[model samples]
Target: MNIEVSTLAHSMLADLHNNNNNYGKAIPGHIPRVPPNIRNINRAAYDPKVLSIGPYHHGKPGLQAMEDHKKRYLREFLTYMPGELEKLEKLNSLIYSVRTLEEKLLSLYNQPLNIERDDFIKMIVLDGCFILRLLIKIRVRLESEADAIFEVVPLLRRDLLLLENQLPFFILEKLYELIPKPNSIQPFPTLKEMAFAYLTMKLSTDPIALNNLEAYHLLHFYDLILLPKPRDHLIFESNQNAPSTVPQASKQEEPGIKITAKKADNFLEVPFVEGKLQISCLEIKDVAIPIFRNLIAFEQCCPTAGNHLTDTRFMDLMV
Candidate 1:
């Protein structure tokens, strides 16, 4: 027993030293998938029904319909470029660039991929081009000649925002840059601007410049735009030994206080007067619930994203 104890302690000490040496190198990106336990609760919330953009759900049976649309978008994008030879050369360059990054891109996900290198690169180009074309079409209000999916454009837009359904932002950005722009006096909008516009179609607030933002994916992009500047007073170092709870609004209202809902610039902006409290209007449609659920789940799983999650908790308190 004494010898066994001595050996275990030395082994643990070796592991501690090894970990210390490895500690300073930062992991490249957060896990792309929802936690398995969370997914078990509502599997549909984190999934895409119509399209699969990244490796996570690529080639799934149900998402096969959109694959043809992806090819069409790629062809349209190529045709819109200057010359056929220029288009071919540009595509070859993109394929070569993405092929070199295959190993790095694979590491972004939490699980192993069984895909071949060439197939994965091809999928990346197709999905990336598809997103680029969709954004431009929505931006320019270009009428689709034959595509049936544009009839249900609203539903298709939501499907793109699913947590598991994302291409790396850099890939999309690169593809957008390579494509030739239609005639314009003003510069073409950044990929971030186009995506934010598409996703938040109901909101009219002017987007902050894309140059100032950094995001891992579409969901992270949404979180950054919705997040307000941090107010120092919002942080509370609690001393409670047990969980803190709030009084029910109805129960507290009996003592001269009143609760009312009002529209705000964004969610989580609740203000109070002497006797009345104003809560921001948070539209909770059945469809939007899954969207919020997955966004919250992403923040919960990625500790680096916890600050945005903290903002969400602030909104919950207002509710």
Candidate 2:
């Protein structure tokens, strides 16, 4: 028994060394599930309640209702494909394209999925097509035309924003590339614009500032718009002498302190100036905490995602 155990250990160590030599330099593909201890704080925020977007929660019991809706959306989407091929032909072509990308897509996640290869490809196609349709609907203000499930656009939007309920951005982009553009002379909105429209549906401010489109997923893009880039020059040299307590609005009306809003390149970047109190154009709704919590989880799991740690820590200080 001892000799058999020793042989197995030696074989496992050899395999580990071989794998490391082949893939040690590769970047992690998928953000990990939230650590158990941290997830205990608010597990619901990390899990999807309405619909599943990717392989993570693909065939869960409660989310089965949306499966038919996703098929309907995919069918509608294929009708808009550039060629005149039959729907089955187009569908088969799409599945083949995604299948070709199977290995590459698998490399994007941190953990290996236990689903079958065909099931994984189907999930990617269905989720990617569903997202494209939703984005197009938002672009044209077609919520009124939505079916029963999407009548509550807010709920669908919330489901899409959940961390585990996400497909990589590239999958959506590839599917988008397959669709034919509108024949109208007017320019069509990009996927990012449509996403920003859905995310900031309740806000009155313009959503045109998200120019950098290099995001891993929708949640990452939302984080890019929500957090401000650091500005070292804005910090005062003599901060030790500054007052910690903020004055009330009525008290600041006197001549001693001046109140003004800073002009910033983007809404998130707005900061207070030196003369008096500065009110930034921040929009914090009830959904803010859970959204940030899941985004922080993503950053923690994937180090390749930029320094969200520093940004989250700074927000903690403000609190």
Candidate 3:
């Protein structure tokens, strides 16, 4: 560095330059100064790595060094790999497994999976894990693009299935959540079961719902009856059959047929063999005769409306 000052700089040289020990060399324009907030870009060009790595160590590292670094990173991340080849082998295997499973699933389903049944649960869980892994791989690639494998992760079907509990409710709920509300269908066996689950958990304020309950029309095995004895049949259906002979059910009969009770246990039941009622059939339905007889036999004595089964303790009562 030149110490002798130009005529232009001679005046600006300070007395401090007279340190006295060295030559009377007034510092040239080289005196160190505090860097301004913004730095000079031109100065970075002289950096050794600027040609390749852009002045950063990693930037200057040649292709070989980059490959070596990648190998080391893979080895360390693979954890079980002994060297670069082993790491590459592990990566290949992992990538292949994900791709193979994804391909098979998409192929079999002909579309994305809506994992509702127990059969689909396992596959959905595996898919979720695979997506998470893909997200991690994307991060490692540093190529921050969205088209990579993770496109499946946030998809509604897998996400919902993943949220399900051991019961696979997560699987069903997710499906419902994703489906447009107006067109959503119950993916589970029965809405009653779903309602029961919600009721059990105290999830919703609405209470028990029943079939043909006037207020709510739920699908159920509707009670059917066949006219039994001629006398009983004449009493109920016969009179009603003839437009005239059928005395309009007196207002009195209306209350019984049209239940106005608050609780279900109070619904009118026509007495049969035992106290068991057949939804008000005058005669034991020929078809349902055995059912009525069986009920009578099972209940021991006459099974009346009073002998009805009512227990909140009942759970999973499929019938």
Q: Report the Cα RMSD per candidate.
A: 5.4, 5.9, 33.3
Q: Mind giving the per-residue lDDT tens digits that candidate 3 earns over 229-289?
A: 1354425564355432222334335545431223222123333333222343234343333
Q: Please write out the lDDT profile of model 1 over residues 1-319, one tens digit for every residue.
A: 6999999999999887654421223343553566577789898888887888888899999999899999988787677568989889878977877887777777676545668778899999998888888887877656546567677676676667677777777767777777666665266777777887777764234555555678877777777777765665545557534435556676658898899888876665555567788877777887777778777876765567666553454445544
Candidate 1 lDDT trough over 10 residues, lowest sum: 19-28
List lDDT for all candidates, in order. 0.72, 0.69, 0.28
lDDT of 2 by residue, 169-275 (tens): 87777777775445552577777777777786633244355645577788777766666666987665774565545446556667666666665545556455565
Candidate closest to the true structure, highest TM-score: 1
Candidate no. 1 TM-score: 0.80
Error of 2 at 103 (Å): 0.8
What TM-score would each prediction reach against the true structure? 0.80, 0.75, 0.17
- Name the regions of candidate 3 deviating beyond 4 angstroms: 1-77, 108-319
Better of 1 and 3 by TM-score: 1
- Of 1 and 2, the candidate ahead on lDDT is 1
Residue 299 displacement in candidate 3 (angstroms): 34
The local lDDT score (0 to 100) that residue 191 gets in candidate 2 is: 77
